[model samples]
Target: MKIAKLSLLFLFLGSFLFAQNQKFTIAEAVNGLRSNLAVKNISQFSWADDGKSYYQSAKNAYMVTDLASHKGDTLVSLYQLNKNLDLDKKLKTFPRITFITKDKGYFTQDSNYFWVERSGKDWKVRDWINIDKEAENIEMLSDNEGFVYTVKNNLYLNRNGKIVAITDDSEENIVNGQAVHQREFGIEKGIFISPDNSKIAFYRMDQTMVGDYPIIDWSVVPAVNKNIKYPMAGTPSHHVTLGVYDIKSNTKRFLNIEGDPEQYLTAITWSPDSKSIFVGVLNRDQNDMKMNQYNALSGNFIKKLFEEQSDKYVEPQHPLLFFPNSNTDFIWQSQRTGYNHLFHYNVDKGLVAQLTKGDWVVTEVLGFNEKKKEIYYVSTQVSPLERHLYKVDWTNFKTQRLAQGVGMHTGILSKDGSQLYDFYSNATTPRVVNVINTNTLKTRNILSAENPLKNYDRPEIKNVTLKADDGTPLYGKIILPTDFDANKKYPVIVYLYNGPHAQLVTDSFPASGNLWYEFMAQKGYIVFTMDGRGSSNRGLKFEQAIFRHAGETEMKDQLQGVAYLKSLPYVDADRLGIHGWSYGGFMTTSFMLKHPDVFKVAVAGGPVIDWNMYEIMYTERYMDSPQNNPEGYKQANLLDKVQNLKGHLLMIHGAQDNVVVWQHSMNFLKAAVDHGVQMDYFVYPGHEHNVLGKDRVHLMQKVTDYFDEYLKK
Candidate 1:
């Protein structure tokens, strides 16, 4: 499938000859770009049982496009019929729908749910089910007999014409249905239901012991101070426990796992028979993890099936499937062999058979086909910079590629796993969805391709592998100007967020800053980004190697990255600058303070000056509590080292940023002011953790001007 949209700005030789750094037209840049770009992170697509595809196209409209249709004349509406009951009239706007029911006819919008049924050419609102109070993220059970959902912290079940509240004491201090900040960082929800719909398992986070970070919401008169339970590095985390509730018995039992409640209770799953629940528990230090099975009825500890120990931190995902007809065999992902691999475990025997072993990381688990004995997944096996669809045999650990694409591939499998709608793309390839028959592994339909960046003459971004001082192969991207000249000694802008939880390198389109980078590069400056040490997706040790020394090791890798950049003949070592946001902001601040001479200019947005000021959960996980590791926290604190700041610095933040609280910026502003340090700062009122929409362009302009004034010679 090929999308013929116009690439953003035309690579006009005249534009370059004019010597005017502006090559990419923002209109052409944003025009050919897919609207999906704005909605990609939120939009979801699901394949119907009969193979029809349904997805969200706008804020409230659900589009049903026939993959079999070559013309792409798709049916789009609000997922509901017109108010006047006419098929030709426009559909009424509704609140955004989140999770869709397994039946595909119904979907949940906030707390209310409605079903659509086809009546000839018109779609009718078949049923509107309200489970009372404001609910969120609702989904029907696999049995289709009831629904499981979350309302704030409470879990609910609506079945047999009644709404059942599964959890009662779901207050601010005691959370049951929702995931914590860590889960948000990990990008996974914290609730699941048993296949039979008889049992529901959820993560209950006890934040009563956690520290409350104050975020003053200034929109209100006199400023209303809101206490948000945010656990930062070196602080006590929220106590977490797993609980199972049985609907028939009206009983709730907490699992009998022994450990610090403040630790992480992650990757919860149920056995196929619904008789037992499996959990992956990682220690607070995250160096050790244990996989245990618990008896669902008695809430008794069945056994510790497996244990994975790492010198660094351990990351656990949802434990793999335990096929119903088979024994307690599951697939678990581990980086014990230095590369992430899948291991098939026999729980009863306590034996783990390595399933998929190689030098690649399983990017994500798509699904498991029990009947076909195939484990479908997306992996970086193709290349570290790209993802591909692959299927592995459950019995033999043999793997086969399902999609042939030299880019990132994400797939949605059919209900029966017989077909898949595969989405593939790269820096150059706009997103294209292709329907394929998984059984025959043949492309059935070329569906939709949307390119939002078609008209922009975007600069070419090339993925490069640079070795760290320790010989760790680090992946990064070099973004250059459209009129780049190797003969010129260009200033270098090092974009970094070398933290443990995030990765920056992917086969995706460059950011809007590519234009800014292009402008800088045209002005004889080079822009680069690297996924340094402590960045995720490699494995436990590679990431947690920064443990207890959060900023130290990350800085080493980034410094190595800077040295690598210096090796380029066109790069000017004396004209290096760095910028980052949040943890990246913390990195920027720490780097600028610790090695002031290395950077000419720096920008830190929403930085954490001191770990002691951070919340309890996240801070303690990495640095332990200040009461325990005052020295580690002190060493990582940017405030103490600010005295060494000799570089030009710019601090930017959102006034309403609850995550890093504006005080993080305010504190640094005060410290820098007291020290008589020259600094520039900006704040976006009414903005939260991020600046978006039209403000983004203005922010970009501000960034360009600041960097140009400070770093450009």
Candidate 2:
């Protein structure tokens, strides 16, 4: 149970440096220096409208490829693209280009927009649009004539040559064209444009009644207090309403959605004709949901098409997907049968048929074919630990697996559903890219990447399967220390994020799936990771098992990992340590304090001390309000168990973190002080939520130092 590869370190200075330069050190891995060692990918690839050709930015130029010949040519030279936009051609880098049709493509150089056309065989370029100023969320209309964007927190519509202000409110509480509900329920942008580009729909949120949490900017001489509108659980949340604007008449009307304004309006969708809009309305309690229809032109409430209810919560993350040719028929995803599956529905007949019924989850729905008879998706049907691409027929629910691989896979289909670009990766493989003919299923390897870490002294990684206390199977991975000795004992570190929408252990890349894990093993420590209940990609029961309980059930499942670790003969039980961020941070802190004697040291970053202090949308959906489920809230609250802490614990947070908030760990420190307990604490100045980019190297170094001091020594 050791690293199978030979060490490349030289004989004299053998401890740190490798001979030729293949040392998997922390500085290179965390400072983003090792990114060049990763498998090269054909970035920004786009399928053409013809379904037999594609455009890709590869080898420093945009290349067009024909499927039959398996050959490519330069679509636009970097020099030509830069010269056409009247820019300096200093660095030959390809711009972000997207295909509009078989022969037409659009790209941006600075604020200037350019359109390149495949005139016969040579590319003809012309200036398209000049963005006069900086804007956010710049989304072009379908006709490519105009776009909707945000400037200074207000919505604006630019059609032809005229720029019109869609909203004029100046208050911070009245924000427009930004994500609402704290980015929950899959609401990314607030603006929506109609099919004909004559009307626009946007969200108007009034956070005037919500509380403003103070966030200090420590970079200033005297830290300034910046208040952000944060609605905690059982608190007064913000109210949101949708408004439609008519560009020709310069008129606006609000949709008459009948509900409490604090309730959630999620998964917004428009009909193909743009005459009607569909919205999923969930109450503040999050137990009941109704798919309601509204008239787009008059901004009138139509009728409720269907409803879904659960004792815990019903989350809607996807919009109604209409067929390519039919305006009335659409597909909807639901977990009403204890599993997430797709169902075909008609506007008039309600449920047409259950299209996809399985014990697995459909992770994503790519799109439908041109004929509206088949759909492409990524699902967990092959295995819970692996994702595979598939196409399911709408008529009979016949499924065909695409992009042959044993691990995670994703693919993009052509507009006519003739060509598919399959990109996949697995445990032993670094990366694999393939092109498959959709009709014949004939495949060709475009790029079979070699293992980049082949020369490094890598640790052996093995996936382990165990069972929970409830007889449910659990998936995990164990990484043995590099240059391990069977006769000697080693301290183990359990890294996890066992929460909803978070799955730590997967069947992708090097088995361990994280460089930090391998680095820890190289430092003479075993690393373990597992996805307990309440994690994602399993069926509904696995994901919802921890509802209203939060950390309770996950702890039960994670303890199973601890039991397995303890049973190992070479594992040092007295020196077990744990580390995690966000929810995993919550788990790390909870495991140390709640169990007291199970682990020796723990490092938690941006953890949840009390569930009541969390946001309204995410917290209430899982744990319910403190008023509704007081016992569950009290059980999961870490502040209650601070007196039981018996290990070397370290807590870290960003000074300006607003997601989990700085107050969470700060309050935990206060609780420890009041209970006459001592724990280590650190803060990153001017950082929010997680320390990212180059600063993350510092964060990981601190984490590694704590484990070394408490466990290794």
Candidate 3:
């Protein structure tokens, strides 16, 4: 008995020592999740038009699986595709195929679009169209008769093998078929095809009036100056207008929008009959919006359907979603009730009904079940950190949860809205895919990804909830160092981004938070991240709390997190460090200067030192114009607060950054010199707002080295 017990003890100790033998390299800590340590997932998973089967892409084949039989078959292979095309060069891998019908799909290869159809036992290419090699922002017609694309500053349409120039602007400042307003207000693409595919509406932005800012390319021997149009707050902004091109007549006309030329036009949509177009016209102040319709062919203004007004700011991010079969009524997402919810409206009746209501917000609208008169959506009704699918009866406004699991659930609905391809992940679950029946709420697990970090020694992460100054609940996470000792105190680093439209903490996979945090924890440091006021996923009140004063409330809430850390027995309050990028970079710099005594070390990258130099659309909405809100701008400006710095500060910026511009930190250095303040500065050449790619490992290593040199000492 004694001999057996000794052997068991030896085996246990060997396992424990083996687990502690592994450590993360800087490269693995930075890019491991995206490369070698990436979790398995279904590639190009989508449902067929019949709603009875789904498809996924494999090594060199397209696979289709029947729902009832749970059996899969090869729909097409790279060999079969190349055999049908008879091309000079064969494809090395299967292209991304998107199905428009049950047995028909299309794929693009070398600027050529091929439509493939499945016969009894083989797949064949039915048609093919070749486009320009330099084409961008390509949008194909619904019937596949033609497509539209942009080349440089002009727009072109290829219809029935004929290329037609839609716009012929001589100057480059007049960009056609491109996103304007710096891609604000949820405008991603530039071209919008009509329902009948007979006409196309595109944005024409004239940026000649905007000021020119140079982004120097320092990679060459003689640096080249690349000037970009940058409109500062309260400055001359770009003028954008929409133009409709009729494919049949080969003619175009600009919309007759009766407003200031600089006003924003968003939420663009088309009528079912293709005779009218809808646009949400917002003024320069961004306080009010009018949903108006226009005649498609003549560009004549029709009646205004409705108007929405807000005291803070009216941000319309989503276009009107018309009912599946009805054109007169549609669903509009609004935050009027403090949370984002859906409201039904009619063109003539104005207000129809409020479909979903709660303290939580609806994140997305999946689809509609026309036969059952039900609408499918994903919402935060369970928790702010979790998203689940829900179905609601439009007639009675009764709602029911259809998705299982307590995590971030995202799904794609079939054409008939009967099956949902649900995908989700949580702290304990790496990934889980399910096919859920909407009516019966029956779920079948398709894929449950294994944890990629099972062999590594991970740190312990616990959710931390604290109260704001107003007693509002603020969520965060505290990552304890590996082999933590409660009796021994350790240095702490706070990584935060407390900016608008960003949330740092969530109940997702790799629950130890960012691997970099875990990487630091293994090196004997604790890491903490919190989402304070001005962060997204909360209600409008939570986000707008920092309005007019960008840094005041956010700092206060972050202090709450600081206080919580100081309360812990294992935290060394005197050795606190902080790091962030972009707006978070702005916050990190603000904290170092404004509250210098709080942190011992700080690293800020691509930070905005002055609000006045930021863009007009985003800055004016939060701080108003620099002219109107001079006091707010003066207080938030970090350049004036440079002399207050007392900690070891390292400021970094990208040489080619156009978003925040390099002038922000350069001017701050000028102020630092005048005040006789000592600080460190670094620059990454030939990079943008963020340092990406393999160089990201070097960036994070530099940040880590800075923290280790200052805080660990």
Root-mean-square deviation of every model? 5.6, 4.0, 2.1
In the range 56-76, model 2's lDDT, one tens digit per residue, is 886657788888787888877
TM-score of each: 0.85, 0.95, 0.97
Local error of candidate 3 at 334, Å?
A: 0.8
Put down candidate 1 lDDT per residue, 467-575, tens digits, no spaces.
Answer: 7777889988787755677787878888888886677888765442344555555555678988888887776557766777778888888877888788889788999
The alpha-carbon lDDT assigned to residue 210 of candidate 2 equals: 96
lDDT of 3 by residue, 1-713 (tens): 99999999999999888876567788888999999989899998888888999889898988999999999988888888778665655667788888887578898987988888877777787557889999999999999788999999999999878899999999999999998888888889889999999999999999999999999999997989999999999899999999999999999999999999999999999988788899999998888999999999999998999888889888888999988878788998888889999999998899899999989989899999888889999999998888999999989999999977888899999989999989999999999999999988899999999988877878999999999989999999999998799999999999999998888887888896688998999899999999999998888999999888988899999999999999999999999999999999899999998888999999999999999999999998888888888999999999889999999999999999999999999999999999999999999998999899998998999999999999998
For residue 485, what is the lDDT in candidate 3? 98
Q: After best superposition, candidate 3 residue 63: deviation in angstroms?
A: 0.6
* lDDT per model vs. reference: 0.72, 0.85, 0.91
Q: List candidate 3 stretches off by more than 4 Å.
A: 1-21, 84-87, 125-127
Rate residue 222 of model 1 by lDDT.
83
Clashes of 2: 0
